[model samples]
Target: MALWTLFGLRQGSATTRWPAPGGDDGQADVLGMPRYHPERCGDGCSACADACPTGAIVADAAGGLEVDYSRCIACQLCVEACPDGAMTASGDWAFGVRRREDLRWAESGDPPASPAPTAGYRRSLHIRHVDAGSCNGCESELQALNNPIYNLHRLGIFFTPSPRFADLLLVTGPVTNAMIEPLKAAYEAMPEPRWVMATGTCAVSGALTGGGYAAQQGLGDILPVDVWLPGCPPNPAAIIEALLMFLDRMPQRVRGGQYGE
Candidate 1:
């Protein structure tokens, strides 16, 4: 134990100072959410929509293309398929949204206005995680939040086993019927001012394979979601940014399914 302690000391702190401006937040070279420039889209181009595996993009008579970020897997197929420069890779991994409609984009789609934090979560948040029917990819990233590198505790966030003590319910995966009742029960147990965050593509839109009777749709279909973060499984840095976005500590990078201003 003593030898290990010395080794630990030698290793020092690998904690990333994210959410603040300076330290390594692990965002460098990360493939983030996609951006959209309607003006750059060809007049009748529908390539991006056709190439999207999840049907997240659809041809829009008005906007040229309508994008639904909730169903987006960030495969970048749309980017590769586009002949024009409408859809480009962006530096926006923090796609946490307070309103679901913000995930959609139409030419006439107005920018989703930011909403104030309604849960009264002024400082520090304890999260209660529930996996309805995940394939375990999301869980792997969640595990990294506790590692020495991320050190999520430094940001005043914690994961608790009981919902009673939690201020936020961070859910991953489709809502399976068997887990629906239990999930509701957990929510009911939590005190008021509680918040719910759908943390991945499965939890946000239930994906393509998640529409059976055994599995309900997504978290929004079952319970109210205060935040929607969509990815096949958002990386560890994205997860932290989503959580911080929920707390109103970070600006939302996504509006109307497109990144940037």
Candidate 2:
């Protein structure tokens, strides 16, 4: 608690003044999305598709490329695989969903409602996270929320160690066979009006480990997932966007969207 206070004090003292309406912050270089240049591509090559571990890139018969944003792990393997600079990483990071379905690439064009409620009406969520035999990437991002940069506590989101006292269960990793029963027990232990968020590619789709001996399909096989954060290890910003979905502060993805509409 003292550490939090000291950090809070430091943040308060280090605050910067707002820039004028048209003024440049000089940090503009840090912003903007990545653009892909298809013209630089060499024809009759499928190296990018072959190199993608998740198979997010596909070459159509017409000799064009299709990148599935939802399936793309953002691992940058394709970016490196593109010898012609056809695949570039973008920084247009404003990925948010009001509906659950908007979280997927195949579900674009649907109208989604903002998932998060307006200010003063947000609910205080107590999240209980379970490892379930993960590689700890999810936990690392979860911990980032508490850091001064994210400061999830400012939005009334708290991480509690005990499932019994939690209002939401934030689960990581694929539900391994051995941990299935324990995961169920934890979900059952939570009180009424509870929510569960599956926070990784392993938890959402099982990904590479979906067919493993220890893996038990996915989290949906056990408890119903309210929100799905789709990444091998989701960025902290993605996790925050998902959390905001549960709070009803962001728009909900519409039908046929990546996340639930």
TM-score of each predicted structure versus truth: 0.90, 0.71
lDDT of 1 by residue, 152-253 (tens): 998889999999999989989988888899999999999988889998988999876578878866888789888898888888888988887788787776
What are the RMSDs of all candidates, in order?
Answer: 2.2, 5.7
Off by over 4 Å in 2: 1-45, 58-70, 83-86, 92-101, 111-121, 252-261
**Taking the tens digit of each residue's C-alpha lDDT, what string does model 2 give over 153-230?**
766779898999998888888888888889999999998777788777677667667657879645777887777666
Best by lDDT: 1
Clashes of 1: 1
Q: What is the lDDT of residue 104 in candidate 1?
A: 82
Instruction: Single out the weakest 10-residue window by summed lDDT for candidate 2.
Output: 15-24
lDDT per model vs. reference: 0.83, 0.64
